[model samples]
Target: MAQQETDERVSDEFIDDTKDSAEREQAHRERGTVRPITVVGHPMLHRECRDVTAFDEALASLIDDMFASQRAAEGVGLAANQIGVDLKVFVYDCPDDDGVRHVGAVCNPVLDELPPDGRVLDDNNEGCLSVPGAYAELPRPDYAVVRGQDATGRPVTVRGTGYFARCLQHETDHLYGHLYLERLSKRERKKALTMMAENTPRYETVPNAE
Candidate 1:
């Protein structure tokens, strides 16, 4: 059996510091004119992502761009909408049992319920690039069966458990116009919003409010 594990000490800095010059250039080119990271309240983030149709150069390029954005932002996973693109795609780089990096992208993805014999639900702290600086403890199924295509449009099926499953579930939610905050309990949501409201000052002095 394949074992899965996540090393929390693996920071975003590790990704940035390790990428070579050519990879960096390719990433920048893939992102093109679009910004790599989009903030909260962006309409694209709330819109349901469209399916990938062609699987041509554009689709492949978008996959690269998603990976670039993921690494640049130091996120375990990223969705197309988070980068202002409304395509059903996401990229993830997580550690294996040996703590080696396993990076990949998925397009027009789908997640099925874990096998009846699999593990139970596990709650973990999760954050999003779209909602920067906010982390929440969200409950996620302990395992997931994902089906999607790779950069070259080849079919792929992955059975993920533990943190990898958590990351995949999180990214899949973004594709469906859902955010982690939506899964929080009412009291949790209120507390989180209050914290955001307190830490994020609103500039009432600006003319927009008046």
Candidate 2:
């Protein structure tokens, strides 16, 4: 998803980085099996994913695979449905506007309501792995918070600012059956799809039926 660095700034307090986070992120990718990403036209990408109920080894494995797939696609964030699994889980390894890296997974994510006083908009170029090779300008909250469970079903709250905030919002939208394209005007959306059709994604994808 457009990892383009920007001058977009956020308060340092919102950054969620721990010393072991990077090491854990690396370990997941190493143990994961990369899976093909499902495209825009695929049914899985168009519908809401099932809320994860079991927080067991199977869920852990899926999160692992998601990290592997996101790395393969060179994405900052990924949702379970993007890998053809209809589960409300997403993994992210993104940096805030300050370039502080934040890495983790969220299951059954619910975006916290942005307060009117703090609702600053950041209009930036956004892309998706499901709609590969295309990006469009979209405005999103410059800061975001999501409440969900970790892979082990532990309650978790994640907050971010700048580009990482965009990543959180984008991945949550995926779980709710929405794509960044949905926020764009028809003309822009068409342009992005045309761009995708004209170029080839570097990563493997599951083709949608014609």
Candidate 3:
């Protein structure tokens, strides 16, 4: 996920960060090896990922690699397919509108339906690590909740509002074979692609095979 720069950060009094979450994120990064991010034209990015049925050391290593990749790309969130893994998994270290940081990995994530009161939309500039240097304004619910399991197979629920909510939705979309570019109009999609072509990404990327 791309970070938006705004002078006014959303102030939510209820937002809080936990020590366990922070420690877990750090541990993953320390153990992870950075991998190259896949670009837009890669076939792996276009297919729905397989559900994660195993919660073993491999899954744990994948999560660690995801965090490492995300940080290397300077992104807030990343899906498995972004690094050539075809599994329903994503990792995030995103900050909410209030600037409260949240970190965790979700497996086989299922996004919950929003209630009537929580349907507020925030049309903010959204970008993807796969898409690289391009960004387009996309409207998404300001609040979101995702249910899934942790690396250890323990059930976990993640909720966020504002920027973090956008990260949850964006990363979940990637797992489902969807990209933020698909949500844009034809002209806007082209515009984003053009921008991508003009700007060289700062990080290494895995190019699609010819």
Off by over 4 Å in 2: 1-16
User: Taking the tens digit of each residue's C-alpha lDDT, what string does model 3 give over 38-126?
Assistant: 99999998888888878999999999999888888999999999999999999999989887789888887777778878599999999
Best-first order by TM-score: 2, 3, 1
Q: Write the per-residue lDDT of candidate 2 for residues 1-210, one digit (tens) a residue.
A: 111122221122333555577898899999999999999988888888888889999999998999999999999999999999989999999988887788999888888788899899999999999988999999999999887777776667788888998999999999999988889999999999999999898999998842
For every candidate structure, what is the RMSD over all alpha carbons to the true structure, in angstroms?
9.4, 7.1, 7.9
Q: Show model 3 residue runs off by greater than 4 Å.
A: 1-17
The clash numbers for all candidates, in the given order, read: 0, 0, 0
lDDT of 3 at 48: 88
lDDT, each prediction: 0.64, 0.86, 0.85
- Tell me how far the alpha carbon of residue 101 in candidate 1 is from the true structure, in angstroms, after superposition: 2.1
Q: Which candidate is the best by TM-score?
A: 2
Q: Which pairs in model 1 have colliding backbones?
A: none
Q: Write out the backbone clash pairs for model 2.
A: none
The best-first sequence of candidates by lDDT reads: 2, 3, 1
Q: What TM-score fits each model?
A: 0.73, 0.91, 0.89
Question: Could you tell me the TM-score of candidate 3?
Answer: 0.89
